[model samples]
Target: MFKTLSRKTVYQNRWMKLHEDIIERPGGIEGLFGVVEKPDFSAIIAVDNGHIHLVEQYRYPIGQRSLELPMGGWPEQPDADPLALARGELQEETGYVAEHIEQIGYHHVDNGGGTMGCNVFFATGLTFSGRNPDPEEADLEPMTLPLTEFERRIKDGEILDACTIACYGLAKLKGLV
Candidate 1:
């Protein structure tokens, strides 16, 4: 195991913190590691009948728009309840609220580089109300598609968000889809 000798914040913002660490390997060799510290997030698979709701938004970092599951973290409330976050994200992004929601899985975003984990939720019995998106998500678009079409989009490399793909796969294996 690598032991952290010292760590310093290289940068910090409301949403994330970047840390540079000095680590000692088992053989007594010292090396540097960079880690991104972020609040835990939630991803929602909002399903109704045979369709799934997803959101498309422009990801500035990637310089493109992405179609993915409704997911987000409350940076100001890092320790917020995962279930609540999932439900809120689904409604905020898709304008649909679920009558039932449950956690299907949990996983780290990037074990090698980040301290962010995601709670995957399976939601059903949805009701359409209206969206209340954050200002940053002003361009977000919501859509509902058949599960098979979603799979096809992933297979075609059109859906590239790791969290969305992993969460859906886990939900599928657990018969939540």
Candidate 2:
């Protein structure tokens, strides 16, 4: 185990904060460590008929459009349940509400540094509703694709979000997708 010697705030921003630390490792080596603690998030894999619901958005930082499941973090509502967050995000991003929602799993997105984890949910019996997307989420558009086509997109690297992929992969492995 590594023991933290000292910790200092390296950066602080509205969305996320970072900490730098001096640590003594179990191997008796002293080194610097960086940690980023962001709020936990939730994502939904909503399936209706034989199609999977996804959102297409232009990610400014990546300068490309990404196809990902409905996902969001509620930093201000940290105490809120992840299932509620999942339901809210699904409706906000995709305008779909599911009668059945099951917790698939959680994933550490960047275990090396970031403390961001995403709770994955499997949503079924979906019903459509009007979307109330956030202004910051202007580029998002909800789309449904056939399960086969979605899997093809993933295999073709068209779907690159790790959390989304991990969730679907686990769902498939467990024969839940």
Candidate 3:
């Protein structure tokens, strides 16, 4: 077991923080662990008329366009419900709201570096509207693709976002797709 000795904040921003912790490992070795963090939240895998709703955005860190599911973090409003967050993100990122939203599961994105878990949802029966994307997310735009094309992109390694891919895969395995 790893026992924490001390924890100190190393960085802080609007969305998340970084912490450095001194810990004693199971083998009796004492070391430091750097952690990046945010409040846990949910993402939605929405499908409508045989097409999946996705978002295309330029990730500045990677300097490339990426495709991903509708996702968001509500750290500042931690008390807000996960279901509401899911619906809000679906609308904000995809400009679509689902008439049926079902909780699928939760995923730990990076257990080694963070405790941030994303709640996964399967949504259907969508209605489109104008998007109200956050200013910080100005580079994002919603796109729709057929299921076969979406799967092909995954197989080709074009869709690189792990959380989005994992959630969709799980949904398919569970016959929700």
- Clash count for each candidate, listed in order shown: 0, 0, 0
Residue 47 C-alpha lDDT in model 3 = 94
RMSD of 1: 0.8
Best by lDDT: 1
User: What digit string (tens of lDDT, one per residue) describes model 1 on residues 1-177?
Assistant: 889999999999999999999999999999999999999999998899899999999999999999999999998899999999998899889999899999988999999999999999999999999999999899999989999999999999999999999999999899887
TM-scores vs. true structure, each candidate? 0.98, 0.96, 0.95
Q: Tally clashes: model 1.
A: 0
lDDT of 3 by residue, 47-162 (tens): 98889999999988888999999898776796578899999999988989899998999989999999788999999999988799999899897899999999999999999999
lDDT minimum window of 10 residues, candidate 2:
71-80
The Cα local distance difference test for each model comes to: 0.94, 0.90, 0.91
Candidate 1 regions off by >4 Å? none
What tens digits encode model 2's per-residue C-alpha lDDT throughout 1-177? 989999999898766889999999999999998999898889898998889999999988999999999999776776579999999999999998899999988889999998888898999999888898988999899999999999999999889988788989988987986
Which of candidates 1 and 2 is the stronger one according to TM-score? 1
Q: Which candidate is the best by TM-score?
A: 1
TM-score of 3: 0.95
